[model samples]
Target: MKNNRNRQVVLKSRPADIPQAHDFEIVESDVPDLLDGQILVQNVFLSVEPAMRGWVSNVANYSEPVRIGEVMRSFAAGEVLQSSHSDFKPGDKVMGMFGWQEFAVVGPAAVTRKVQEDDLPLSLSLGVTGLNGITAYFGLLDIGRPRPGDTVVVSTAAGAVGSAAGQIAKLSGCRTVGIAGGSAKVAQCRELFGYDEAYDYKSDNLDLALGKACPRGIDLYFDNTGGVISDTVLRHLAVGARVVICGTASFPTWDPWPNGPRAERHLLVKRARMEGFVIFDYASRYEEAVSRLSQWIRDGRLRYSEDIQNGIECAPAAIAGLYRGENTGKRLIRIR
Candidate 1:
């Protein structure tokens, strides 16, 4: 078993709803041999993102769906165990699409970045200092441009992306309001994440809660979950409001296209602008975002939380936990 024990979680079948543990099979295989330009990386942490739900779904999406029997796609950070590439050497830390596996045989082209850990933790490459922060940076600043004193609202405000987006909006001089699922997360949003106001969307009267939180109506909205929560937010949008469609975490599938209230009339009356953004579109400018995020970290103007789970065995349930609101912040699998 030691000789052929590269344990990995592979998709056993397409999930009819949200993917569950039964849909994956963890199997052992021989560790891959190194090629001329490839390196062997032993993963340390695997990111549990909401986007993974869409990846495993049997429906159309912005990217190709993960085929059955393939290693589940994920972002991970790890150390190079062996290398045959000129750009990388053993002991170097890196982050990329390394999937839900213990060890990955990756070429130089597959490496997203060779991490430079000056005073930062390596796990952050998969969290705050990585895609989560980058998504918040561009999506809020570029699309949902919150002006000074403007009331900016964010859905899923305690999750990774939403937390960062709310904090960024607060730092930019906006009156930030966060909408989370429960009382615990709502408190975390206001106390820990620096949101000026927060409300529990699961409350009996969410419209009243939102109205009380944002008495001026919402000027900018960083929308992460697009369902009834968003439907309510749309009703209170200030004239010329800008909405950033970041994710639809509340929707399980889009095959039949889940129906909701129409937006044309709201946009027409409010003259609101809604735009969609994908982080990969700004890949060329990652350094720019990272620089600002790092500075914010250094200045103590930014803070983040991570809900880490140990062992590769816990990988299958991580995504489901994210959907169920079981995590308080960023969800990750620490594969030792």
Candidate 2:
């Protein structure tokens, strides 16, 4: 009977600045009986993303915060074990916001899209060919609009979304420059993803590195860590540049309004446009992006990395690890 129990993580408290283990509680309960129109899923991989920080915070954001005492919101890829839904059957693979749990009983609305077995690992559905890929594809191409010879700079370049965005920009004929937090990530951006240039924002001189790497100035800035790193990048924007504000990793809290150098004058002088992106905005077209991302991988034009933690017990600290920059690529918790 213990084997039939479902283990899950729930939010104990909304985080003040950064999430800690105490903020989450792992609970085990009897697996609920399947309901009409519901499918039972045995979650395999749970995604840990930066956006989770905002989801658990009290700060205003694009989406509603994960209410306290609810199962922590997360994206997961899993296999169907039982189904009352017409389309899903036992053994079918699926991906969706299945939360941080070993098993979930959900309806069709909870499943984002059905996944097919392919040469790529199913975990890729949570990273390169999933949300990260879709986010990078539309966020960079549709918003940043990089052109041939354009200097495209991506902050947090070693991260899942940032790495994919940089690679896509490179494939589009743009000169890609990645800004990462450490020497290891910088090396990864350059060696693994083939960024034209990569810099360790922690160790490298910000001004000097930008000057050397972007001699013509940045034509497209994919700003992920939108604190000091983005502030410095703004100083190098080319005329008519497009800045895609994909994330704000460095800012711990937005409620108090962290102060930094304003980009108003810079934007005006450079005649550039800056915009924010939410992956859900492009939800209807995720399949299209995933197909192309898959093709890119098959043709060897794209690559991805995953840092998998092997237990549901890791859920509490998984997102904290992301907040600390402990993850090199996509962070996933393997909870089979």
- Candidate 2 least-lDDT 10 residues: 1-10
Model 1 misplaced regions, further than 4 Å:
1-4
Cα deviation at 79, candidate 1, in Å, is 0.5
Give per-model CA RMSD: 1.5, 1.3
In candidate 2, stretches whose alpha carbon ends up further than 4 angstroms from where it belongs are 1-3
Q: Write the per-residue lDDT of candidate 1 for residues 223-308, one digit (tens) a residue.
A: 99999999999999999999999999888888788998998888899999999999999989988888888889889998999999
Superposed by TM-score, candidate 1 places the C-alpha of residue 312 at a distance from the truth, in angstroms, of: 0.2
lDDT of each: 0.89, 0.91
Name the lDDT of candidate 1: 0.89
Across 201-264, the per-residue lDDT of candidate 2 in tens digits comes to 8888988989988888999999888988998999999999999989888988897998989999
